[model samples]
Target: MKIVSEKLAQDQFTQLKLKNLKTILAESIAQADRGELHNINDVFASLTKDKHEDISNSNI
Candidate 1:
């Protein structure tokens, strides 16, 4: 039935997403072990600055 097929497709998609997430997590752990990291505050500050700049540019 269509419903069964749709469910199977959704399950496959979920599995794929989980696999991708696991891969990303492993890469992140490896990067951390290599001392490749950023400060959270700095990241947020950069984002905030960029957002403000975007708003100012839009007003022009």
Candidate 2:
């Protein structure tokens, strides 16, 4: 009985995650349709810069 309940809970969590992912994808599509887009390279570069800044700050 305990095992079954645990499995059910895990399934519910998985479903919730999938639903959230769908919502995010829909929002991204709408944004793209409105010409609100970003360059992938720029996003990566920004993330890398932030990570480097974090590391440098930690050293101080």
lDDT of each: 0.70, 0.71
Error of 1 at 24 (Å): 0.5
RMSD of each: 9.0, 8.0
What does candidate 1's lDDT look like per residue over 1-60, in tens digits? 999999999999889867866765676667667777465453345446756986999999
Each prediction's TM-score versus the true structure = 0.62, 0.63
lDDT of 2: 0.71
Show where candidate 2 strays beyond 4 Å: 40-60
Scored by lDDT, the top model is 2
Q: For candidate 1, report its TM-score.
A: 0.62
Error of 2 at 52 (Å): 17
